[model samples]
Target: MSYGPLPKRIDPRKLAEREVRFESSVDVDQLPRLVECLALPDGKIEVDLQFSVDEQRIRTIVGSARGDLHMACQRCLEPVEVEVAATFNLAIAASEEAAKQLPRYYDPLIVEDEEIELLPVLEEELILSLPMVPYHQDCSIQTSFGDDAGAVDADGAESASEKPNPFSVLAKLKGQ
Candidate 1:
């Protein structure tokens, strides 16, 4: 089936009763906020969502979103490809007030008009899941200061003469 634009507004009540399932792909360009951080935002994001009612008769949305984004590495300022993914279990609340009482396990999704926009929701989750500073898992930058100044010596050895004898302080205190 041709997956077109994902639904903007989702009616939680009907979706919960019918236990609807949704699977779609959205182009990277469609999510403007997410694109701003990317060095290359050329791929499509996959979204898989399911709507159902819980044992407490509360409407819920359970889903995951996944995609790859090229972000500037904070350390090297080079393009570093990273995976952005989020798995969410959310309770659909009728009002902003109702959302406050939601349990910690379920993040509250407030629906003022009884409908929620899917695009922003998905975009937000992916954005929040991203690292604050995107960088390679194993970055190869040199990280050290000199022994006399910052890190150990070039020979990876610190001579005994370099270290102040611990007993020297005690000798001074004794005035001997």
Candidate 2:
């Protein structure tokens, strides 16, 4: 099914009161912070959000974001395709005190002027979902620095290195 453009800002409390369910796709270009981490910032994020008042009588937003992103591979230093996704349970809070008082299960979305910027919140969720060191499962590049066989003698015994240890000089100086 087709979805409309995402609204830039939203009043969470009002939306929860009305029990709104919002679904949309937003271009990656709209979220600068999320784009900065990507190898190629050319993708669309699919968002689904349901606003309602939970049993605790607190206004809440239950949402998920999904996207195909390209992040630089740490092993090969090339663009690697990655799937990013996140689900969030957020409680609307009017102030810092209210935010701190929220339950552990709900992340606080502190609102000012009864509205919050939607793009940044969504961007944060995507960013948090990204891998710290993204890389392909089987990278094409060979990352081995030295052959293990070369470090062993013909009899399959470990051999001392032919190169002198740089730390040996420090040890000699300490002995003197």
Q: Which candidate is the best by lDDT?
A: 2
* Candidate 2 residue spans exceeding 4 A from truth: 144-176
Model 1 TM-score on a 0 to 1 scale: 0.77
User: What is candidate 1's local distance difference test score?
Assistant: 0.81
**Backbone clashes in model 2, listed as residue pairs:** none
lDDT of 1 by residue, 1-176 (tens): 22566787777778878998888989989999999978887888899888899998888989999988899986667889988899999898887789888878999988878676789899899888988978766666543455554444334454444645779989999995
For model 2, what is the error of residue 157's alpha carbon versus the real structure, in angstroms, after optimal superposition? 18
Candidate 2 C-alpha lDDT tens digits along 1-176 = 22598777888898899998889988999999999999998999899999999998999999899989999998778999999999999999999999999999999988868778889999999999999988888775644337643354323455665545679989999999
The lDDT values for all models are 0.81, 0.86
Model 2 gets an lDDT of 0.86
